[model samples]
Target chain A: MHAVRNIRLCTKDCLCLYVCPTGATDTETGQIDASKCLSGCRACVDACPSHAISLIPAEFPPQQEKTVSVKNALLTLAASKMDQEEIASKLAETTGNPVLRQLAEALGKSNRLMAEDMLRESGYMLPQSRTVGELLESLLSEKQPADFPEAAVKRLLELVNGNTMQEGKASAFEKIDY
Target chain B: MMRKFVCGICGFVYDESLGYPEGGIAPGLKWEDLPEDWICPLCGATKVEFKEQETVIPEEKKQSSLDEEHQEKIRELSFKELSALCSNLSKGCEKQYRNEEADLFRQLAEYYDSKSSAAFEAQISDLAALIEADLSSGYENANRRAAAVSDRGALRALTWGEKVTRILSSLLSRYEKQGETLLANTNVYVCEICGFVYIGDEAPEICPVCKVPNLKIAQIQRG
Candidate 1:
């Protein structure tokens, strides 16, 4: 875990600067330098006056698979938001009045953002994540339609495989050849 | 006499014009006339969880349709409501042990809450202006926060959000610049699964973001 500072609540007390053993908190941008900070060392987190700092894990575990019910609910909500966005976009396009058009555009944008948020929450936005990779793998292995974008899936697999190969090479290079 | 009711839990809007026949609710049925035990057909949320669409006025009373004051009020109320929804969603993510997803929701909640303040500051009655501010802050914060945590899923989500925001921003700007000329030439398709918007003559064979087939992409018609 590394300490992070929420600049919003930082009071410029400089307490973190004084107590840090590695001087990771002594930054001009009010953000803790994660590299210099010791692992699990929360001296600054404890000493901060405004409670602006907290420890976040350096590595997060793989996300758990969402239940079918939750996934269905999220997709439904996403579709509903898309419907609202479509209405707002159409209104924006059709309206001649500048103010009304602007308002409609804003509505469309907000609805789209909300929909994207739900997509992220439902685990559909992470194409490069393990779950997504696994999903793509399964899809590719199955009997897919002729127009199922097989090339895209293959490209994704290549990227994953390339990453694994690079990592393997790096580990091999780290070994001391006797 | 038709009014819209929005589900607080899922953002589902029940339009009187297209009454939820799936829920056995007949067309033209007033929201008040619905049974006391009625629930959201989509999410099963109780009647109490449904809020009337605050800014929508009847079509016959077109003159009373969203004025500046009403627009500002609705904008503020919508931010508050969106924040509440984010909070609920974060709790749900936490229940599933999806920490990164939960964190993203918390960040979204913070962004929207802060945006409500920005809206108040700018007195932005226009929804597009509010959304611009939202996307600007959302991507910036997501980039910064995602770096501090090593969640690949969170990072990918943030990157995707940024890309989509950029596309939408450019599209909206083009619409603003060209007006009806642009609208006349192009059609808008929305992905029903993930809400990815595509603007062109036809929908893509597959969604670039969600990878869903074109069947899930529905064209948004302009009347």
Candidate 2:
């Protein structure tokens, strides 16, 4: 495992800089030098005040399996959440009252949140899960709504099937290897 | 000619025009006409339980919907409530991967906690019970009021909130059954767009729900 900084949470406490024995933490770039960071050493993890830094395993465990019943239940919940989100967005767009519009926006955002949770629980949101590819394929086959995020999904499918690691930023294991 | 009298103990209003049908009392029966043996159906209080109630006009029902006693109950914000609100805001920020904002909110929560003057520390389960009650009836009341005034935005928010809460409640029950096993070995990733949580070695190329790009997704580093 190696420590990574969530830049958003790093409040510039600079405790990580002082505590890192290898001087791996760079405040300028806000990226930890994985090569210099000792695996399993959590000095900065404990010292940081904002708790923005955490350990990520060099190798991730495989995806967990779900039952058929759980999958069905999740899909049903997702469908309803989607419908609610759409309705909320429409209401927000048409409403003239500022408070009402904000309320509608919050509702739409919350519905999306719940729907995502359901999808994650059902094994559709994980890149390593085989169900992801299958779901993408099915979505491609179906007649989706005009606003459906087809292009993004297609790009994601390509990335998932090809290089799981992102460019410019290598996996933690790869960075530590060098 | 009929008036309503509420049970002080249970908030069960006894309307003379619509007498407790299920309780075997017929419509148009005056409170004085009913036998003294008739008790509060909800709390089994005696007829004397009606002493605190006044003659409530039907049309002005909305004005008295939240009585003085209830208003007083919510008048002051307890330390626990503030802490809970800050904690909730922190969690919301965490979901959006706004780690800095989340940390700030968490600090606020801790500040509230340090200043908490309650005789006892609040239990999370007790908070859960309050949330359950709110999900069950609070949104419904708000929706009814919004519908009355034809407020489309408020109505939409209430409708979505109620439906999502119900769905989440069911999902939570299922999670309670085997959440540990379900989350045994996988890493959890959350999409910044729709707040979709992904469990894997890494985030999905795209959020299945919101279809946001990989750059927008981030792993949850629990604090």
lDDT of 2 by residue, B107-215 (tens): 6556655554334332323323433664655554544444444544344434444443543333234335554443455454545554444445566566544455778
TM-score of chain A of each: 0.64, 0.66
**Whole-model lDDT values for every prediction:** 0.56, 0.54
> RMSD to native for every prediction?
20.8, 23.0
Output the lDDT of residue A174, model 1. Answer: 36
Give the docking tier of candidate 2.
incorrect
Clash pairs of candidate 2? A8-B100, A9-B100
List residue ranges in candidate 2 displaced over 4 A: A8-13, A97-99, A133-178, B1-223
State the displacement of the C-alpha of residue A3, model 1, in Å, after optimal TM-score superposition. 1.5
The residue pairs that clash in candidate 1, if any, are A106-B127, A106-B128
lDDT, candidate 2, A105-148, per-residue tens = 54455555655444454443334335545544765797866755
Q: State the lDDT of candidate 1 residue by residue for A70-167, as single tens digits.
A: 33334444444455455665666666665445545554654666565655655543323454455557757878555455664565455432211122
Q: Each candidate's TM vs. the true structure?
A: 0.37, 0.39
Candidate 1 per-residue C-alpha lDDT over B35-137 given as tens digits, one digit per residue, 9 for 90 to 100: 8756555333457656789764543312322233233321112443345355545654454344565665566556555544321122213434544654655
